[model samples]
Target: MDENESRISALTLGGAQERPMNEKLYMLTLSFSIEGFIRQVLTQKNWEKAYNKHDNSLRLTIKLDIKNNGRIIESIKLIRKAIFFWTRNPKIDHRIWIMIVKDDTPFYPLEEEEARQLLFDFNRDIEIKPEALKKGKNNIAVFVELSWGKHEFIEKNTLKKESNIQQIEKD
Candidate 1:
């Protein structure tokens, strides 16, 4: 080994591919060496930062316009009943449940906290039966009741302010 050369600990790569009819696939790839990965991991304190970021980047986009007093939308239909679920948080209050509706059919309600966590947490996995999916736009609705207190909605300015009381004393 040359005096200037260092040992290689790891290697990483990222790529994507796309193709059209009778056309060659388009591809892009990027590789990272151990030093760079180690630098990022040490600075961020997260070893899986790169993997997590890439995995969570893909998404399905949908937009819904809500009408006043519209409680339910009945345009989507599901052909299957079985589904799988997971959420960002590993543990949540399982007693409360939330409803997930597809057209007139409703899948079994997921735990209240599980639904909330899944909606916000991108790292988790959720799978619905393939037969339940439609070719294009599909209408689905979620009905949930989340009770919040004053503390839950604290303003950012309030969080930045220093506490007025410097110290506490017990009488």
Candidate 2:
């Protein structure tokens, strides 16, 4: 093939196709459920978003503002289950791991040992089988054991959970 043809082929080659509407909804639901944990750790209602890449895989990073929370430990406790659920290999659809970035920058600064401990607690909360976590070169990752399909599904349980958590806190 010529250069022009080769360029066209590369552009067309690999990309994830759109998932079904229901599946998209499911993926969003799953994402929302996982993101909800940030609320407990953050003083703000919204957290920043970013995509992660390592080992040739795309992971999502929810750069949470975990600074203001008086105690990051308790917030970690509350969302332990939800974090594991969303980060699991496959649940209501979607296959990806998650990392909650907690830093003590202006106050405490980043510490891998502390971060590892928090990750350990969160990993234990997951109901399914979880693999031993290893700290990657730049960061840490808690691996989940399961093969997730490309179907991308997110269930509708998020709204109810959001409401429940909201009601409990009493803004």
Candidate 3:
């Protein structure tokens, strides 16, 4: 076999398809925040840096950006500690919901059904809007309502900001 043929075989040996040099992988960045009843859960150090008590409800904002690809979602998981913080108070009954909005119309194939499926696969109980799915560059916003109590607070801390990027490649 020629050098070029051997190189091609090597690339495909692991079930990896050869992509164009110009083609880049997609990246999704999710920025999350926690607010509301934080004092009950956060440590003294984290509380002072990441605690915000001025908002009416416990809010978690997840800003995600997909790059070089057009996949809706991979997975979703809730932080039990954060949920516990908001639910500890017996006097407060919070109804939490998630709102997902597309900042830019996503590329084709990333439609409402895909988005719905992503959410459903993650958690069947959570509620999501069908209209939230739209075609755009690759920007999506996810708002997670942690709690809805009378108290108000806003927390901004480096530790509270959770971000993740997932790259999906088709064989």
- How many backbone clashes can be found in candidate 3? 17
Model 1, which residues run further than 4 Å from truth?
A: 1-15, 19-96, 101-106, 121-171
* TM-score, structure 3 vs. true: 0.22
List runs of model 2 lying over 4 Å from the truth.
1-78, 81-109, 122-171
| Candidate 1 Cα deviation (angstroms), residue 34 | 33
TM for every model, in the order presented, reads 0.18, 0.15, 0.22
What lDDT score is found at residue 15 in candidate 2? 18
Candidate 1, residue 8: lDDT: 26
Q: lDDT rank, highest first?
A: 3, 1, 2
Q: Model 1 — which ten-residue stretch has the worst lDDT?
A: 158-167
lDDT of each: 0.24, 0.20, 0.27
Better of 1 and 2 by TM-score: 1
Candidate 3 segments exceeding 4 Å error? 1-25, 40-75, 82-136, 147-171
lDDT of 3 by residue, 1-171 (tens): 322110101000011123334553332323332222333232222322333432322333332222223344433434221211222334323322112222222221123333332222222222222233334433333322232232222234322222232223332
lDDT of 2 by residue, 1-171 (tens): 322110101001111122354322111011122222222322111111211212221122222211111211111222221122123333313333333333321112133233223432221221111122112211111112111111112211211111101000101
